[model samples]
Structure formats: C-alpha cells, structure tokens
Target: MEKNFTIASLEFCLSQLKRADESVVRKAITSGDGLSESSDDVGQKLSEAHKNAVKQCLTNADKLATLHNQIDACDKVFERLQNMLCSFQNNLGTIGEDMKQLQVQSLDIHQELENRQKVRNELSQFVDDIVVPQPMITTIMDADPNERGFIEALHELHHKINLISSRGNGEAVAVNDTIPILENLKYKAIEKVREWLLLKIYQFRKPLSNYQIFQHQLLKCRFFYEFVLNHEPAIARELQDEYIDTISKMFFTYFKAYASRLFKLTMKDAASKEDSVGAIDTAKSSGISGFFAAKPQVRNRATVFSIGQRNGVLQSDFLGALIVPHAAAQNNQSFQFETLFRSLQLAFVDHYSHEYLFITDFFLVSENEALEIHSKAMARAVSVLLKCCEEQIVVNWDAISLHLCICLCDKFQQLLIEREVPDVNGYWETMSNILWTRFDQVMTNHNDSVRMIDLKKLQNQGALDARPHFIVRRYAELTSAHLTIAKSNGKEIGPKVGALLESSEDAIEQLLTRMSTMQTSHKNKHVFLINNYDLILGVIDDNESKQSRIYAIVHELEQKSIDDFVEVVLDPHIGFLIKFVTECEGLINQGHTQLLVRYNDKISTVITTFNQKWKQSIDAIHSEVMNLFTNFRLGTSILQTIFTKFVQYVQRFSKIIAHEVFSSNSACSEMINVHQIMLEIKKYKPVY
Candidate 1:
C-alpha cells in the first residue's frame, strides 16, 4: 500500500510537470514568432501541438483511473489490519486494568481483616481498663485527704472515659457497665467538693483577685462540672445553682467591704456647725443654690446593683460576663441598666455638688478669687461641651448647654445679690467676652463643616432642603442667659453686645482682605461682607424684643455696622462707575461733528475695564457669601444703580443731538443717521 501511494503520487507529479513543460515550450515558441515577425505557418504549428497535448492528457487520465482502483484495494486491507491491531491493544489494556482492580480489592480485604482484629483487641483492652483507681475512691473516704490529689485522680478517670467513648467503635457499650460505678464515686465526692469550693470562695481576698474572684473561679467550676458530673444533668444543675448562690454572697461581701473603705477615705467632718447649717439655709432660701446642693437619697433594696462608693464595681468585666448567660436564659427582661445609671447620676450630682461647693467656697473668700474661678469654670465647660460634640455622644447637647448657661448666670447673679461681687462691670464684661469667643468658635467650626459638604451633589439630587444652614443653637442659649443676667442686674447689653459687634466687624474685614489678597477675577467680597453682616444682624433680629432696652441697643448697633460697612467698602466701586458716566456725558454735551464716533471708541475701553473689575468683585462676593449664608438671594439693585446714571447720560446726549439735527437743514440732516450712533452706544451696555 505504501509503495502504491508513492507511485501514484509520483505519477500525478509527473503529469503536472509535463503540462508545465508544455506550457513553457508554447510560451517560447510564441516569443520566437513575435521576435522573427513570423506568419501563419508558425500559428498552425502551435495549434497542432495544442491538439496533440490534449490527446495525451486524455490517455493519462484513463491510466490514472486504473492505478487508483488498484491502490484503493490495497488501502482497504491495510485499514483492516490497523483496526485489528487497535482492538487487540484495547483488549489488553482492559485486561491489565481488571487485574489492577482485583489486586486493590484483595489488599482492601486483607486490610479490613487486620483492622477488625486490631479494633477487637483495643475494645477488649478498653473494657478491661474501664474502671476508676481504687486509691481515688479511698481518698474520698479519707478524712483529711489531699483535695488537689483527689481532683487529679478524678480528672484522669474522666479523661480515660472520654477517650474510650469518642472512638465510636462499639466500645461505648463497654462504658455502660462503668457508668454506675462512676456515678457512685461522683455522688460521694460531690458534698466534699462543694464544701471545698465554698471554702475557697469565702477565702478569696480582694487585693489578690482584684474583685474578679467570681470570674476567675467560674471557668474552673465549669470545667469541674463538665468533667465530673457530665452524665448526671440533674446533679450538675443543682451543684451549679449552689455555686452561683455562694458566688452571689461573696460578690456582695466584696462590694460592701470596698464601699466601706472608700467611704472612710473620702468622708470629711464638718469644719463648723454654723457653716453647715448656713449652707443648708442658703440652699433652701436661694432658688439658684438648690441646683448646687448635695442631697441625701434612700437606697432601693430591690435593685441587684446600686451606685455606691465607686463606679468601677458596676463597670466590672466579671459582672457583665456573669449576667450575660442569665439574661439570655430569662423569660422576661429583668435587667434595667438605666435604673443603675440614674442612681449613679443622682449620687454623682450630689458628690460633685459638695465638691464644687467646697472649692467655690475657697474662691468665694474674695472677689478676685471668684473672678478667677469664674474664668476657669467657663473655659472648662466650653472645652467639655466641644469634646462631647466631637465624640458624637448621645446626650441632650442643647439642654446641657442651656443648663450650663443658666448656672453661670445664677452664680454671677447670686454673688451680685449678696453684695460680694467686686468690679461688677469687669465681671459681666469678662463673661460677655468669654461667651462671644465661644460663639465665634462654634460659628467657625460650623462653617468649616458646611464647606466640606457636597453642595453641587445635593443640588443635583433636588434634596437641598432649602440649603441647610449652620446650626448655632448654643448662641441662642448663651444670648438668652446674657440678657437674663443683664435684666436682673438692671444693666444694658450696650457695651457687651457692642464688644461682640466690634469683633464681628474685624472678622468680616479680615475675610474681605483675604479675598482681595487672592486677586481672583471675582467681585463677591462686598457681597460676602454684606451677607456676614446681615447674618449677624439676623441673630440679633431673631431674638430681639423691641420693648427691651438691650434689643434696642443691639438693633441700633447692627444697623450702624451694616451702614458703615457699605459706605467704607462698597461705595467706592459705585462712585467710580458714576464718575465714568459723568465724564462721558460732558463729551456728549460738547456735541462735536464726529463726537459720537470718538465717544464709542473711547467708551468701549472704559466699559471693558469697568466690567472686568465689577464682575470680579461680583463673582467673589457671590461665591463667598453663598458659602457663608444658606438659601441666599441677591438682587441686581447694585447693577441697576450703576446703569441708571449711564442711561441718564445717554438719554440727555441723544436729546441734545436730536435738537441739533432737527434745527439743521431737513434734507441734509436726515443723512446724518443718529440711530447708528445709538446702536454703537448700546454695544457698551452692561449685562449685569
């Protein structure tokens, strides 16, 4: 078959070569004819050769067909032999795989028998060794046996029982016979172990355990129950309950002992009987003093935990862990931490009240001392409030702020009423300044937060909610407290609020200066200053009572500040625009022959300059003011004011030109075309 295929391939190649050689010979003959300029005889010879080649191809085709049929017969036999060989090889591979599988089966059977025998031996050994040591039982019988020694022996027996049962190889049935014996030993040891555990609990010392005896011992006791009485559920429950009850007693004992110690360390004797009685009398007489008074409380015996000498007791990790399992298993919510928190709060108020009273009494000896105390107290209070806000504590921030402000007011007023305060104006001024500083801080912080917010994102979502403003809740509280103090003292907040207003003016001026320094192509500084002044005015306006004297003073101050700011900062730009228009009007009044053309060329430059400066200012003012204020609306009144004067100048110039035109020759004057001049002037009109 191989030889036949080679011969057929050679024959096909030879036929193709012969055709290629004939084609080359014909091409050569045509080239020769063209070169020689041959006639019809050469063409006849070429036609004859083509006819002969066609006949030869027909003969070759018939021969190739015969050869192809013979090669096909040999190929069939070759293919049959190849198929037979493949089948034989496949059969051999199948037989080899069967033998390998049979070997594996035989090995598995042998391993199974061996494993069975080994398991039987292990089971026999487990059955034989399934008994506790006799000495451990004897030790339980002994009067003063080693407690730890007995525990170790029982642990060994428990370990062995677990090891054997966990095999699940039918050796667990062997332990059925050992259960009664183990139970009997456990029953005998229970009383002794309970007594020993109770003794250990009672003997625990606070200094050594750090009040965590119960937590430290719980794990050991749990392990003991799990190992010793694991098979006896009822007995385990009874023992655990007893252990917990004993723990409860120990907990109380430790708590009480610690409480007593703390009370001894903290308690102080009354320095004078008269002072003590006077303090009580003052608390009762003065409404403000009661807030600072230390009061007694009757304990609630029903509460499992109560506020006492230290907060650490209630916050102990052991107590929390101990209560978790109980809380989880309870049918009802019996635990109420809020009650404990409340108790602690009341007790804390009392404790701190006394401490605060004592400290203030020392400072109250002199006016200077009192002022010092007042400064330090207010500073600390503001610091703590800011810290609480930063930490995001869940507290009534507004209420606490109000209470603190009220307390400050009361403290100052009481001192004044008693005629003990020195430098009355100094006291109130210092307070007003402190409060203003705090207000400024709050506003600054709020502004920073507002700046970070995604304003564009919020606007796009249509969730602007009127553009939320920075909250100044404490500002209201502090102001109200200030007014209340002022009213009680029969004083006015003219100087106090006047000081704050000055501070506000300085801050606005600084901001405007900064915007100018940046040299941005925006004109919003004036607007920003205006809006900030307006916001400050709004605060006063929001709380102002027309009938009140302080409100009147504040209103007057705010109005004056706004008017002054506008004149000093904003009027210059408006005046410049006015001057430029006045100069243009003067040129128009002269009415030269080519006056309008010259004016258009000159004023175009002026208008460009004016718009650049004006637009820059406007942009700066708008951007900064919007950042400071919420839902701000601006008017084109400034633009209108600027343009109105220019409109007057243009109208007056037009009227003069019209009069001149009408007075001249009617035919020649019509050709002047004044409307073109008006259109050129209109090109310089301000879009703003």
Candidate 2:
C-alpha cells in the first residue's frame, strides 16, 4: 500500500510539473516577447530555460512510470500473503477438531483399560479364593458363615463343576458360593479377556519374535505350582520337573525373541559398514551364548535322589575340586570361584533345600507376616516379596548357591537329631554300618605300628610291588556285653536279654584273620590299630610307599578321584566322606550310641570349610532380606506351616546350646524347658 501511494504521488507531481512547464512556454509565446534586437538575448535565454524545464519534467515522468511498475509487483506479494493467512486459519481449525477427537479417543481408551483392570483384579481375587476349590463346593462352604477349611469346600465345588460340565451346561449358569463365588466368576471372565489380549500380543509379536505358545506353558507351570504340587509335595519333585521342562522349552522361544531383536539392531548397524560376520559375532556374545554353550553339558534334566549317599559323594568331589584351587587363589579372586560354584549350588537348592523347607515349615515361617498384615486392610497389596533368584532382577552371575545348601543342611540335620526325628534319611541302618567300619578303620589305624615299604626300589627292580595290606586284629578281651540270667513269674531263662545281640564271632574272627594275612612284600602298609575310640597309628618312614595300594584299591572299587554320582562321588580329598557315610550306616545297624557321631563329624568338616571360605562361595545374605531365610525353597508356597515351626526350633535350640556351653553354672540344670529356651530366643528376633 505504501509503495502504491508513493508511486501515485510521484505521478501526480510529475503531471503538474508538465502542465506548469507548458504554461511557462505559453506565457513566453502569448506575451509576445520579441525574438529580435535587445530582447533577442532574453528570448534565447527563455528558449534554453524552456528546453531545460522540458528535460527535467520528462525525467520526472519517466521515473514515475518505473515506480508505478514496481507498485504492480507489490500487488502479487499482497495476494500471496492473503492466501497464506487463509491457509494458516484453516489449519488451526482442523487442529482444534482433531484435538477434540483425540480427547474423546483418550477417554475411551482409559475407560477400556479401567474396565479390563477391574475385571482382572476382581477375577484374581475370585481365582485366589477358589484356587484349589470347586465352584459348587465353594458355595456350600460359603453357604455357612464360618470361613474355615475352604479347602474341602473348594474340592466339593470342583466336583459340582464336573457334574455340571458333564451334563453339557458348563457355560449355562453361574454357581455362587460362600467364598466370593460371583467374584470368582468375574475372575474367570477377566481371565478370558486377558487370554484374548495375550493372544493378540502373541499375534503381533510372532512374526518378529518367532515365539509360540510360551506364555501358555508358563501358565501351565504356574498351575502346577499353585494347584497340583502345592497340595502334595511327594509329587512336588515330579511336578517341578515337568514345570522345568516347560520352562526350558519356553526359554528357547524367549531366546529366539531376544536373539532376533538383538540381531536386527546389530545388522542394521553393520549394514552401512557391510560387516555381516561382525553382527553374528555380536549375537553370539550375548546371554544366548552362555545358554547354548552349556547345552552340551546338560544332563537329561537332573532329578532328586536320596541325599544320604549321593550328598556325601558330591560333597567330596566338590571339596576335592575346590580345596586345592581355593588354597592357591588370591583373596580377591574369590568371585571367580563363586561363579563356577553357582550352577552346582543352585542344583543343590533345587533338590534338597526346598524339600526340607516344605517339610520343616513349622520351624521356619514367621507368625507376624508383615506382608499379610499390611495387605489385609488396604484396597490393594503387593502380595509377596522378591525372595529368590528367579524373582530378582539384578542377580549377580557369580552368586554361588552352594551356601544355600550349606544353610539348609546345617539347620535341618541338627534339628532332626535334636528333635529325634526318626528314619529321616531312609538308609539309617546301612548308613550306620558304613559309618562304623570307617570308625573301626580309624581306631585300628591309631594303634598299629608298621615300618615303611620301598615303592621306588620295588619298581626299579622290575617287580610289581606284590603287596600292601590294611591290618585288622581280633581282641578277645572285649566281653561283648552278655546278659545275666533272670527269672519271670513261672519261668526261668538262661539269660534275661535276647541272645540275638551276640556278635558273629566266627565272621569277626575270619574277617580279622583275612585282613591280617594279606601283607605286602614291603614292610609297612600304614598299619592302623583299633581299640574302641583309642587310635594309635604306625608312622612309616617311606611315606610314598605307604599308599602303594591306594590306586589299585580305589580303581577296583572305582571309588576315588572319578565321580560316582548316581549314589554321588567320593572325591579323594574328602574321601573321609566315604568313611562318614559308612560309619553312619554302621552305627544305625548296631544301634550304637543312638545316632552316628562320625557322620556328625563329617558335618563339622563342611562347617569348617564354610567358616573358612564363605566369601569364596559368592552367595551372600541377600541385600534385601525378606523374612531372613524364609524363602528357603523356590518351588512353591506349599510348605508354609512346617517351615514356620522349623524357624522356631532353631531359635530354641541355639539358645539352649549357647546357655549350656557358655555358663558353667547353667550346665548343672537338668530337664530344663525346651520351650523356655525358645522363649529366650524370641528376644533375639531382629528389629526389622
């Protein structure tokens, strides 16, 4: 607009100037100014001024014409700006409409999410209430106001459900019950919806992940743990196995997803550099490699066997492998060993620790469970805690589980003895006998004096060292506890006690003679003399010759160095474990001094290792310890009761032992209250 105005003003001014110039010319001519004589100079000056004025007017007009043309170009710019303003206004209106639609969509999505969550929550409660119960039975239980033993009620409900389903009306009607039956129905419905969502997610994820039906298997595992295994632990081992099988299969699916995601990222990165092998190498370096590399060593899914025989052997092997390495390693290098020990330790927990946790729950679980208390009143609660490795996120790869085995073994074994739990290990007699023979060997070893043999000379002389023998002696001075004769009301007997108690004299004699006769050509065989607990060993001069028969003996039995893990191995270093198991068997068979102290010695040995090198076994007291060792087992919540009792037992026993051992005066008190000791232990409960 400004440019247009300026141009118009310029044109007007120039036109006025042209008119004025013309008037000047007319005045000059019309006023009759002479072109001759004295006026000739004035006429010539007028003509020149006229020409100059004409030129000035023409220049002004020409410039005005150019300015008008520039003004025309300004119109184009003005039109473009007007169109831009209109487009911006239109876009703003569209955006406003879009915002309203988005708000509506957001509200709808929120409502949908709320509905689903409500369904999931209500159903979860319903499902929890009747997790092990049937619907009809739950109704019957609920029919009564008393809320006890919903277990049976649940069973009854299941039967009813079966009956209804059998009649082909499975989906027809809802059966309400005492224990949140309608809520349970909604719970199931919510489950259906969740399943649908999960399926959708699966569909979306499948092409990218190649993962199939894995979550379903996880659900099945959850079921087996919650329902079948929780109810019956004899089957727990078997069911857990099935769960692990499913887990292993599912892990592969998870691996594929993880592997593919990682690979795609790497491949994309490498595409610019054209490095395909680099991508593959990166994939292999991830967690999937560890899994695959360990695959070749995977046994046909290890299962639980009796711990009595097998544990001793395994302990021996592990100790043998560990001791030398442990002794040589630097203090800070413990973490490396911890990593190596993790798999075995976990394996130990999976087998033994959990079983004991379930069975001994009475002594383990706390009464005032804070989680339960807080959750009871609130509208919502975070049900349990992160207790085990599976539950935790930042699990250290070097977390050695061996300590878990040690923890369970120590408490449970001592508890069994203190409580006089009978026949716990199942091979009490056999184990006692084995224990006795080792003890006998130890006793004999202490008493005998034998000269050392020369292994070097025998070998160099081109003669197979013919012999070395473990000596045995018969002592008739031992009267073997014969009973005195006694009389009953009407009858007299030769002896009051039964004669079945007599030792097999012939067998004992022959055994001693045979052991004594098998002497080696070399003088000393590290002869061990025995007399009850008294031990006296013969110090041999040639130490290397003393164990000449060790290789042959161990080889024949396949007993040393190599692992015999079916019943478990007896590593040469902890070969004393063989003696331990043997002595335990011997003691049980003979009913010698109640239980085997020899086996107890073995336990003490393990304890010594633990005390000395606990840090070497990386499993630490968990950073966030919930209920102390409450999550003793990872399998299930099935054994909550027995485990609770065990905790109580340990508390009591430790206090009593401490009191007796530490105070000379307190030791005199006999027949004191075990419960009293427990009460004292209650004082030690952590303030957490």
Estimate every model's Cα lDDT from 0 to 1. 0.43, 0.33
Residue lDDT tens for model 2, 394-509 = 22211112222222233334444554432233222332233334323322222221112233443443423212211111111111111100110112222211221122222333
Query: How close to the true structure is residue 281 of candidate 1, measured as C-alpha lDDT?
Result: 17
Off by over 4 Å in 1: 1-120, 143-147, 159-180, 200-209, 217-222, 242-564, 568-688
Alpha-carbon lDDT of model 1: 0.43
Best by TM-score: 1
Write model 1 residue lDDT over 1-688, tens digit each, in one string.
9999999988985686587668765775777655234436556888999989888878798888899998999999999999999999999999999999999999999999999999999777676567666786687656442356766766665666566457544446657767667667666666665565455545543344642444345344444555445645666556544544543444345334433332222112211212110011112334676567675332222111111222232223212322222333353333232222222222322322332343244212254554444444333333332333223212212211222332333344444455433333333344334444544444343233333334344335443222221222223223333344344334455564445434433443343344333322233434433443344335444333334553454445445544443343334444454444556557656765355444434444444444446544444433433453452332333333333443454344335435442244233222223344345334434464
Of the candidates shown, which would achieve the greatest lDDT relative to the real structure?
1
How many clashing pairs does model 1 include?
13
TM-score of 2: 0.18
- Return the TM-score for each candidate structure: 0.28, 0.18
